[model samples]
Target chain A: MHELAVTREIVDVAAEKAEGARVRRVVIEIGRLTPVAPDCVRFYFEICAAGTAVEGAELEIREIAGNARCRACEASLELAGPVEGCGCGSFDLEILAGRELRLMELEVY
Target chain B: MCDHCGCSTEGHEHVHEHTHEHPHEHETSRTVRIEQDILARNNRQAEWNRGWLASRRLVALNLVGSPGSGKTTVLERTLKELDGQMNAAVIEGDQATDRDAARIRATGRPVVQIATGTGCHLDARMVKGALEKLDPQPDGLVFVENVGNLVCPALFDLGEQAKVLIASVTEGEDKPAKYPHMFAAVQVVLLNKIDLLPHVSFEMDAFLGFLRQVNPRVRVIAVSGATGAGMLEWYECIRASIH
Candidate 1:
């Protein structure tokens, strides 16, 4: 799947950040609307990280909640996933957040 | 005493204790603030490709759909109808074959075939490479037909002006609901194979309702590549877009 490619990128990024040091942990933030499974990422990370600087690194994934604002009423709301309309009966909504997939930090030794 | 990091015995509790007694002393372990997007590389390439296309005033559209959804047929039909009116090229992406490229070549259009091997989707870098090989003329239109996939292809940005979803009625009415991410990411939906409406159990009302629920602002065009029905509207849409 594409998760394999994504995981490869994560490892390369972490390894580049670590320089010559060994990475202990890698922290990542994934948004709810990104459509990537944390477990699938983890599965690929283990394989991609093998023999790299992040070989034994522990992966921590944080899910960011989806946030949106109504285009008509300008009212902000949290969504579990992509929704049809806002509570104010407005089908026009602008997504404010929850499409992020970032490598936040790396603990290295 | 803790067994993990080997700090002192006093007030260790079980967390990592990096507090040294000396003022200038430092621990070997450190946390680096990366704060980088995982898709930064791909996004950078996509931006470059976008700028390159914009400088030439060229338009690129990425077409995505499930296999057997008539994506190749749609392109073949588009090229046939828009033959002399519009100058266009095709970038065909598949897991293995260049058969689609041969088909597009038969239409007398420039074509490049990218075989991803085991990869499921085409990334921005792949498109950039293909563009260099094809080297389309200025002010021309480029159609990057992504590998037939409803899932992973939606996640990648190929530096196209917009993504068009090709769905056939035989795939069912709930495709938009089943793959909301793909539906949400596309700017237009081409409901292909409409000529089979009488034979299939597909309901137009339900399909439109589900598509609207998933993406409120997407343009939907119902067409049949085999019958050439409603293809005039498609050519008109293309003309309207580039002009």
Candidate 2:
């Protein structure tokens, strides 16, 4: 799964930031439309974090809802997944949010 | 020594020592604000690759598709037709085996095979490694046939100018809706195995409709790698991109 590769990256980033300190928690923000499964990330994070500074660290994930604005109609639409078109029958929709996958913060001892 | 407990004599303070290991009970913890993109490393490598390609004036296309979508077949045919006309090389990515690389070598072209082992898709770093080994010339076409996966490959950027999707008629018309990310990411769609249209239960109109619903700007070309049908259009499309 792509989540496995992504989790390795998460562990790497966290471990580097920890910098010899034992990590207590890792907070990540994933958008609803990012196509990354949170459960899979959690599963892989444990495996990827083993023996690293992030080992046994709590993984906290926050999902952000998809928000888009129609370029043609200028209407804001909240989406759960990829949509065919905006409600205003326009294919020109600019995504405002909900494609984010970021490591927000980390708690370390 | 006696202080609170007062168990010792005057001028002495009594202290209690812990026998159990309480590692973090008194440890001070702090939160570090990172606020960094998770794919930042991969994106940085991709940007590096983009610069490398732009500097050499090379156009690389990332061909993504399912396991049996005939990507290698289409690629073999494309390389043969472009022989002596346009210089080209290939970067074949698979979970294992150099079989595809052998096939490309048979076409008398420079090819590099990247066996990802347990990796599901090819990342930009892997492509960078392949680029160094392949060393395709300027004004040439480099086709990167990604691991035959519609899902994971769509999420990775290999610094290609455009992503081309190879989907056959047998994969069902609802492919676009089923895998929207892949459908939305590609610039061109090569609907291969058009010769099998009569035998398969694929609806061309419905497929096109579903494809349009997901990606309104994507160009779809129906071609059969087996019969060499509609290959001219595909070649023209490639020529348009390079020129």
**Interface RMSD, one decimal, each candidate:** 1.7, 1.4
Error of 2 at B42 (Å): 0.9
lDDT of 2 by residue, A1-109 (tens): 9999999999999999889999999999999878799999998998999999999999999999989888888999897887547876776667899889999999999
* TM-score between model 2 and native: 0.91
Residues B100-140 of candidate 1 have per-residue lDDT tens digits of 99999999999999999999999999999999999998897
Candidate 1 stretches with Cα past 4 Å from truth are B1-27
Model 1 C-alpha RMSD to native: 5.0
TM of chain B vs. native, candidate 2? 0.88
Clashes in model 1: which pairs? Answer: none
The CAPRI quality class of candidate 1 comes to: medium
Q: Individual DockQ of the candidates?
A: 0.65, 0.62
Model 1: what is its DockQ?
0.65
User: Which 10-residue window in model 2 chain A sums to the lowest lDDT?
Assistant: A83-92
Residues A1-109, model 1: lDDT tens digits: 8989999999999999899999999999999989788889998988999999999899999999989898889999897886557887776778888988999999999
Candidate 2 docking quality: incorrect, acceptable, medium or high:
medium
